[model samples]
Target: MTDDDLIARLEQQERDLLFSRFDFADAWRLGSLLVEMATERGLPVAIDIRRGPQQLFHAALAGSTPDNDAWIERKARVVERFGNSSYLVGRRLAAGGRELDASLGVDPARFAAHGGAFPVRVEAAGVVGVVTVSGLPQAEDHALVVEAIERFR
Candidate 1:
């Protein structure tokens, strides 16, 4: 599909994935769901859930490495900074014939506009957290997180 088409789908995902409330227990359930899915599929994924600056849940499955953790942080930063799924942000930039760069005021070091990170948006509280996964291909990484959230909420 085209970048615009992908962006539209991601927008719909963000809108549909909203939560009424999110807390530590909710974080545990969501994170655990992702973990179970990965384990069932034997997906070597690292999952992370965060509320603002505080990390709530983290897991590294077999074959997952520290690099996956780093990727999670970068992708989550993209969600926190842009208030959109990391994949959506990247697609929007590409559709505009742009990318992450100094001119865009986005630091590649700290923020990666790649798939894998999704915002944990609470309708009443706005975007209060991020859910991220890494290890698979970028889009699959994104789809994994999205699927978990869709199941959780």
Candidate 2:
């Protein structure tokens, strides 16, 4: 898809993925659903669900390496910092001809403006957490999380 198309998709995802209420149970269900989808598709990935600084669920599927876990952390940081999907942030940066690490002074080690991490918004509460995946291409990773959230919701 074109960058503009991706940007629009991410924006719509951020709006449609909201939860009326999210607790530990919801986190567990969402995390499990993501894992199942990846496994069924034979996608190696690391998944993470977090609220603020608190990690609610995390899993590294078979074939996922330490690097994938690191990507999850960095991408999650992007969502936490911007209160938006990492893909949206990355697309916005690209649209402006800016790089997340360079123009924003964000440490590359701590933040990544890429697909895969998405804000977990609660209705009327704004973003309460993040759900992240790493292993596939950036867009695929983002799509996986989006699909799982849609199913879970």
Candidate 3:
């Protein structure tokens, strides 16, 4: 196969793997998958998950410095607390309303980080949680969560 073809195949394989929704034992499982995908793509990543007030799981890859777990946690908390991601928080705030700042026990400045993170909501179980992936650029982190959510859905 040509180099282009080989690259296409590899990309397809990664996409397929990422799109599969294997059973997540908990938020940790979800975070682990993100790490795996990030590693496969040669992207440094730090991943974390939270369910309600508790941190479900967290990990920083070998090359990743332990930058800030609190920020990752904040992203998750905002998602779970608001039942949506911080992206939504802007709307609520822009409407001339105040949000309770749902970072839970996490620091308020934690949300200032530029990485992507989101809440996990299981309608069947009535459970809400958050998932975050850092280390990559902010858009990439957001894309990771978005892709995972799409796969899970």
Could you say which candidate leads in TM-score? Answer: 1
In model 2, pairs of residues that clash are none
The digit string of per-residue lDDT tens for model 3 on 85-150 reads 554443334344444444334456655424366655454444356677776666567778777656
Off by over 4 Å in 1: none
Count: clashes, candidate 2: 0
lDDT of 1 by residue, 1-153 (tens): 877778889999999999999999999999999999999999999999999999999999999999999999999999998899999999898889888878878789888999999999999788999999999998999999998888887
Query: Which candidate tops lDDT?
Result: 1
RMSDs, each prediction?
Answer: 0.8, 1.1, 9.7
Question: Model 1, residue 95: displacement in angstroms?
Answer: 1.2
Model 2, poorest ten-residue lDDT window? 100-109
Comparing 1 with 3 on TM-score, the higher-scoring candidate is 1
In order of appearance, the predictions have TM-scores of 0.97, 0.95, 0.63
